[model samples]
Target: MYLRRKPIFFLFLLLHPVFINAQFFADRLKSFMSTAAVSAVQYPKEVKEFYELNSYRFSWLEKQNAEQLALLSDYIRSSPSLGLSAGDYHPEIFPIAAIHENDSLLTEISFTDAAIHFLHDLMMGNKAEPLSYDGLKYVPACYNAAALLNVYLSPGRFANLLTDLEPKEAGYLAVKTKLNAWLKITSAEKYEDVAVAVSKTLRGNKNGLTRLYQLGFVASDTASLSEPALKAALKEAQKMFSLLSDGELRSTTVQALNVPLATRIAELKNTLNTLRWLHCVKQERHVALVNIPSATLLLYEHGKLVIESRIIVGKKSTPTPTLSSTITEVILYPYWNVPYKIATRELLPAIKRNTGYINANNYQVLNSSGKVVDPYKVNWRSLSAGNFPYTIRQSTGCDNALGLVKLNFYNPFSVYLHDTPGKSLFGLDRRYFSHGCMRLEKAMELGRYVLTGNAVAIDTLTEKGCLKNQSPITVPATEKIPVFVLYHTAWIDGTGMLHFYEDVYNRFSPGRKP
Candidate 1:
């Protein structure tokens, strides 16, 4: 009976190599993981789940393949070119030679650790240093380790997966190429201080023209170029910085050139991170993006840019909030419902000085119950800043604070995009004038584009003289455009030109070296 039982057990063991192999390798992996160079804390939760799902099978190690180890080594060493710190992944801790010491446990553990760290940094940008300011509330996308591993394990897809990990936007790729150029040339050339408007051309000064060539702003040999050629190069540079393009060495132009190369590189890094964050959204339909720092609005349809316009964002004290929402409707000659803070802090003093101010501006005072209250009935003298109990609303007209068109979106800040009567402000280089809303430069064009599919409503409103009428014209958007209001001080244009805007809110302080 004992001999018969032994043979049965041996047969059962021989038929279960799949389970036996998995159990044997899993035990070794668990033992190596306990004493691995990388700690458990360093492994993200998703990575742990990935290993559990695979039953601790080694992903990067195929019986200690040298080709796989070399690929990882090259990738880690090339991280700096992508504005990443290879040291954070610590690839040097486990040299290829050390990994190939013929100890399978050590080799497998090291290979897994290096591959996971490299992937983490590549997918999510090198975890940004703690920011000192809250001016930007954008959060970067994190990696799902299990999904990433699945992609890696799939045949003939690893290369594509690697390409997809980086930002696929043209702007980001252009900026990254520029970053590499900046790294190679290492320019310290700076312009001298000048007045607001300087009419001199860099061709007059041979040294200045040489510096321009070094900075890659000119197309040809700048040093030997004629005065007209030099002026054209300077004009191009001015345009790149969003200046007036007067082809002169103005103070603002000089200041832009004097910005250190290292500072520009840091801005490029921040822009790359921002691109990664923005690219995570898969929307390809009609969308509107408002770049706060640049004070510009861009509209895209089917992933193609259709409209670009200047905009006036909020001032430093009441800066616009970064958020994402959908524009559901466009209101023509809409009434401006004054916020409580604006009513008590900005307009109350004017009303006190002149009782007719409200009448002159077509404003009406209303109680909480929606009953119109006579302005004269309210004791202007007794209404302290805190004790004001009335809401001031501007009637619909050309003189309305919101101009002719207002874009309605769902946001807690109660901020919207609208036209402004202050048209001259749009021509200024620095346009931060609004309380919190965005003032569009070409508001009518934006309105026409958003109301494209609803042509009858727009035509009817235009025929009815909506602009001059006091009655509001509501146009329901047939196609809702997703609006993303974000702040990016640095970006690249479709022409592959690097554009840098002043950090008006001062969100990024580049103190930590990469």
Candidate 2:
């Protein structure tokens, strides 16, 4: 019994210093946390909770944590390439020379605070500014500080964790590469603003030629070129600006060319932020993205672009909203149920003027009981916008407002993607003529893509003749495809060329500088 007791006593003696050191660290942390200075920590609550979870142990000060500390410092310093400000991580407070000093506790806490803040920004967006447009809802991935720290502290995980968190989408990576290149170029040289005379043609303007040369649109600035060569260069510039490539310089093209380089950089940064907010798309198998500013629709399957189409969005008075939803069904030979506002305010005047207008346009007037009524019998002149109570719907045919097909999705905005009879609108450089819904140039293609296995159904409906269809045929989606209606003024094309577009909605702040 005496020998066993002696062994237990020796074990206790050996463990005494470990317990005492833990208590000492806990007491110091508690005292410091109670002071007002702790409030200066960016994430004080997370920091305290982290230490408490580890029994008040010093994590960054531990010798084994040196690798992760160095990696984190590198990531923080290089964060600008990710469209994040390194200063936000408090890099100046990193304690490289104070590991053995008496103020090491403060240094530990500061480093921990920086790590938490950096991880938070990496997982979620920096959210430095509110989105310019309303009705844009995108929620990024989320993770707590304690959980992220545990993963970072684990063996052989720091680098892999970062790689996982970073966006791997081709579009995002292309923009990031361009942003880094621009940052280096801007730091090395001051870009001179190109001045273009609006009254003169850019074909013969020396300044315009130099600007085109600088932008790599033309081969040479000093050498004299023929009129055809100059026109071609102007067309290239127009294409880069996502304008009409008509080989003629217009006032709208002049505005794009005169956009300052610094403003372009700011636009790139805003694009990065927008992409980060939409990070959830990486996990999806199929996605349809509509960029309103560019008036383009891109369909992706298994992370590859499957289709690209031109789309007509809403006009200025009724701008299309940015939202995320899933396409659930496709309607063939769909009827257009004109909204109450459009029916009352827009079509009412025409109907009153011409009693035969409704039948000429294939529009039917339905009363409260859902029965068709003769438009000629109704008192059209007596019905004002406020007093009109009938539902106006267009019949199914090639001439229907929603031509051939319609893609249905649930959104509070009551907007959906559909085919339009105005095929000529797709040829325009800027197509924003819709009321609020999106008008698709290739609605049948999109319908088939969403209904992958049942694509023959679309062909069958179309072959049966549009005028013969009495009612809309609905095809439920086997797998609902996600759709994101976005607004980006700057984006990198597949060829790695960056394209800038007009801020159609005036979403960017006025008088903003880099």
Candidate 3:
């Protein structure tokens, strides 16, 4: 009985130092947290909660957790590929080589703080500040930082958890993959500016083909290629750049090519940030995604694109604003209720110049009582912008400025998607011609899509047309489709091809050139 007691006492002696060390660390951590210096921590709340949950255990200093710390450091260093700046996390301050016990405890707390920040930024996006013009309204996904660290701090879980926290959308992944690839390519290659010649053909130009090949626009840099092949490659490059795609190496194409790889990388980063901001749209079933920069509309039904159309957005002077809303009503042969500003500032001069202009353009002058008054009866020359007290409206017709269809959604900007009589403008490459409204090339088709089950109603509306005494047909959407007017200058298309557009609104850094 004495020998057995002796062995048990020795076992207790072996565990005593371990317990003492843990208690010492816990007390020191508590004292450190109580000090005002803890206020300097980037994520003080999350750090405190994390340490409290573990009873102030040294998470990063433990021998078994070294691999986890190393993995976290790698992630911090590589954050730029994820559209985050590594400097934000301050990886340099991490005590990777700390030899002192106090340094180790401080390192543990700092690691937890930085890890929480990185995880929060990774999940909820780094750009929390709102842009005045971006009109981003959706709330990002929320996460408990302390809870995440508690679950994912183990050796085997940390790396996988980092990957899992990243955005899983295909578009985002594609851009990330491209960003990494570009990082590697730009590191190895020194790309020189390709000179643009207004009169010379770039078909046999070695410098042009070399730059195009480097950009993945052309298959090869061989100058012996045929004119047609070179032209086709140039068109492909132009398409990717959102240029005219006329198969000519014009100044715009040269400008796009001359844009440095660093600028392209920055553009890609901006695109990644934008995509993360719009991550909520992935859950939406039916959506009308109007990319303002690309001047295109993509209608998605249950996450699959059903309709793609060219669109005319606002000109630079009156850029279309980014906003999110739902399509509620569709109108066929819609009346153009000219805004007071347009009436007094734009059309009033025309009315004054020729009283017959109003009748020729199918415009109706409405008095304060909502009665259509004759434009000829009013003394047009006598009315100035400030004195104008009437409304001007274009009657419903094929020739109406609103064209044949209008999709209305409630917004403070009073902007809506509509058809335009100026169909020829849609054929142009740069379709920025509207006055802050979106002009859809397939407005009638969009109306049909919105009123899917009401085919008879669509047919009846089409037959009615712009006939006199017939009011415009109005149909409410059965299932309201969410519309997101976004401004993304860079994006990956459905074909997995990367494309860049001119920053039409000059919203981003390095504003659009003349």
- TM-scores for all predictions: 0.76, 0.78, 0.80
- Relative to the true structure, how large is the alpha-carbon lDDT of every model? 0.68, 0.75, 0.75
Model 1 TM-score, 2 decimals: 0.76
Clashing pairs in 3: none
Of the pair 1 and 3, which is ahead by lDDT?
3
Per-residue lDDT of model 1, residues 71-110, tens digit only: 4556666666677766766454434332332355554555
C-alpha lDDT of candidate 1 relative to the true structure: 0.68
Question: How far is 133's C-alpha from truth in model 1 (Å)?
Answer: 13
RMSD of each: 10.0, 9.3, 8.0
lDDT score for residue 14 of model 3 = 36
Q: Residue 151, candidate 1: how far off, in angstroms?
A: 4.7
User: What is candidate 3's TM-score against the reference?
Assistant: 0.80
TM-score winner, 2 or 3: 3
Q: What is the Cα-based lDDT of residue 213 in candidate 3? A: 72
Q: Residue-wise lDDT of candidate 3 within 65-134, one digit each (tens)? A: 5567666777777677677988888566632432354455566678788888888877766774233333
